[model samples]
Target: MRAFTALINPIAGGGRATRHWAPVAARLATAGADVRVELTRSGEHARQEAQAAAGAGRVVIAVGGDGLVRDVAGGVVPGGGLMGIVPAGRGNDLALALRLPADPDSLAELLLGAEPRTIDAIEADRGTPGSQGTAAGGVIVPGNVYAGIDSVASEIINASRWLPALVAYRLAPVRAIAGWHPPVFTLTLDGVTSTLRAHTVVVGNSGRYGHGLHIVPPALVDDGLLHVMTVGAGPRRAVISFLRQAGHGGHVHRPEVEIRTAREVTIAADRPLPVGADGDGLGRLPITVRIRPGALRLIAPPPEAHAT
Candidate 1:
């Protein structure tokens, strides 16, 4: 039997994670798997517990939202350990991107029977001293890293956690856009540099964010490349239209939207701007994001199911 360690954030999704974990744990125990449960106090604590468990040859399972998954992956990836997930938070975007089974029985079967698939991840270097949930000067992102207005919107969504997920995710962007102005952005991709006035820039490995927005429609976790989406500057009405169309990726066809692939990308702004990864804030602008190929070994659905 495989030894498994589940790092859970009790407060994630307003305690939804703890409620969701019960059936999953029961299923795992019924299968005779050696399962250890650890309730994480904070993102940094989750990282430490995951690292220790991974080092002990245990499969580390993140039992919370996208933020927890990112934190736990920071620990599991460095040691070449396998990881799994139970989507129990407000925005399980990473789990959604990977098509993870939500049913406890199916999830348990997949966890016990599936072979780990190697996938890419994004590494964001804040170029400053380490902060909470970050190591050294960088952090591992399991989904996407973004800046500009989107980051501000992330702040709003995180703060409004008491509201329903749909209500918070929908209203936060509107509030963020109300007082926002486009900023000049400097983007260096691979080696070429370009300057633009844009509303947001998203570097994605899994393409999904903002609770299912297809921000980077062509992003793939195993593609070994980062998909960059630049939402060029536009009027408030146009920006609203673009976001409405973004639900089904119709915004990608708009003139202001640009998507490209790169192995590395450096994002900087004229002034200080917030940077966010997965669903949490990283720091400020002037961040370097690079693709880490095969950095994560995840127990997910087959490759065909992951195709867009």
Candidate 2:
């Protein structure tokens, strides 16, 4: 079988997409798999390439970060092609969510050897009502259900000038400290709509967010359920407590945090909201997010990592 590996942003992880290809190519060559490597010129290039190969004929591995995986996965959706990971992207949230090894070699083995399993991928975007806003202002409805925190998305959009995305996140909390600029949005989950002024809201497919943060750690990737978490800045003591738990991946019990589950969710605001899912930017809000179960097949760690 032919195995094509696409490198998505490798700037953060030792430029593995371009730098580590030699060894990986040799290994795949030795294994008798026609391992072809491709360098993505921009954000969605990998997705385009994966779309070109979607089918039972090829096994495509996302050799970069979660963004790359999401792109390729989106492209490979509905096809029988197999997928794997090679965590060379910043945050690598999807990798962390799946418990895949950070090392490329181990991941390569899991990629080339594992039994392919189908998983769910929620569709996310910004720029309409319910999660997206129109110019005049109206919620753009979603056909699927997904959960996400606009705070991270806002940071990425605000930091787009930075060539390396991770650099922006490293400085986000500090930037957020100067003065609070949390956006106000209406979150609708399980038919209950609540307006929340929040610093972050995370919609999770599987438990985890940037670098293993348990924003919705109990989310499962295959349970056909989506997890929603809205984090607001409560009292000063609460903010400190939130930060401590956020840093350790155990912040669920905080009172200021709202957690819910749904099959479809709507989040919208008067202003454009930035969004990131599994780790990719959704540009701006006025958007809709919904879960698309069994949308893609992923090879990764077992159920605990997938327990929604």
Candidate 3:
């Protein structure tokens, strides 16, 4: 029997995963899947467990939100293993991007079918020492890599992970907006340099994030390109208003926001700015993001069911 290992984040979706995993696991077993479920004790533990499972040639599944997916992908990507996601997290942007079913049973059905396809992954690395830059760790973002105000906002949202999703989603941004400051950013896209005073720079591998904001509406998972968006430095009121408009992708059409595509991007700031991927803060800039096309195999939606 083919082995399948699920790394479930117990606290994901405000403890929804903890409640759901037993039934999900039972359903998968009832369907004759050779499945074993493990609850992640922490972020690092999830990565270590996922790495070990994938290295053993088992299909490693992430059973939580985007952060859990991020941890699992970090382990699975290095081994070229097959991955599946059960969208039990607060912001399941990767799940939305891949057009996976939200329910656990349907997810189990999809996993058992074992239809895998190649998808692009974004690899980010920071500049080395002797530099004014502060951090050295890197991240592999499955959905998006964003810096500046968005990162600050994500940090707030993550810090409130214990709150109910709807309340936290509405409250966190307001809190973050009060403390946000626009930073002068220098960005390079595919070797071309430009300078801007911006509140955020979002590099998207898949556009959907923040519980359904089509931040980069044109992003495609299998495409060999990254969508880079710059949200210009604007007044607090304006930034908050833009975020409101962003719910329906209206922000992309705003004068302060510019959208473009690139194979690689470099973002640096006058100060160390916060950066995040899929609503989890990775580290700070100066950060370089590059696309590795078809880097991993994922269980994706059927062609007709996929989001455009």
Q: What is the TM-score of each candidate against the true structure?
A: 0.96, 0.81, 0.92
Report the CA-based lDDT of candidate 1 relative to the real structure. Answer: 0.89
Model 2 TM-score (2 dp): 0.81
What tens digits encode model 2's per-residue C-alpha lDDT throughout 1-308? 54665544555354645554456656667778766666776545666676666664677777766656766776566455667767665566667666777555766676678777767767654434342222222211111222223354335434553445555544554444455566687887767788977766667786665444555756777877778777775543354456558766567876777778887777776566555555545556645567767767767766453223
Candidate 2 residue spans exceeding 4 A from truth: 8-14, 78-80, 125-168, 235-240, 305-308
- Listed per model in order, the count of residue pairs whose N, CA or C atoms clash below 3 Å is 0, 28, 1
User: Which candidate leads in lDDT?
Assistant: 1
For 182-263, candidate 3 gives per-residue lDDT tens digits of: 8899999999999999988999998888887888987788789999999888788897788688888888888898999999
Alpha-carbon local distance difference test for all models = 0.89, 0.60, 0.81
Q: What clash pairs does model 3 have?
A: 65-89
Q: Rank order by lDDT, top first?
A: 1, 3, 2
Q: Which numbered prediction scores highest in TM-score against the true structure?
A: 1
Predicted structure 1, TM vs. truth: 0.96
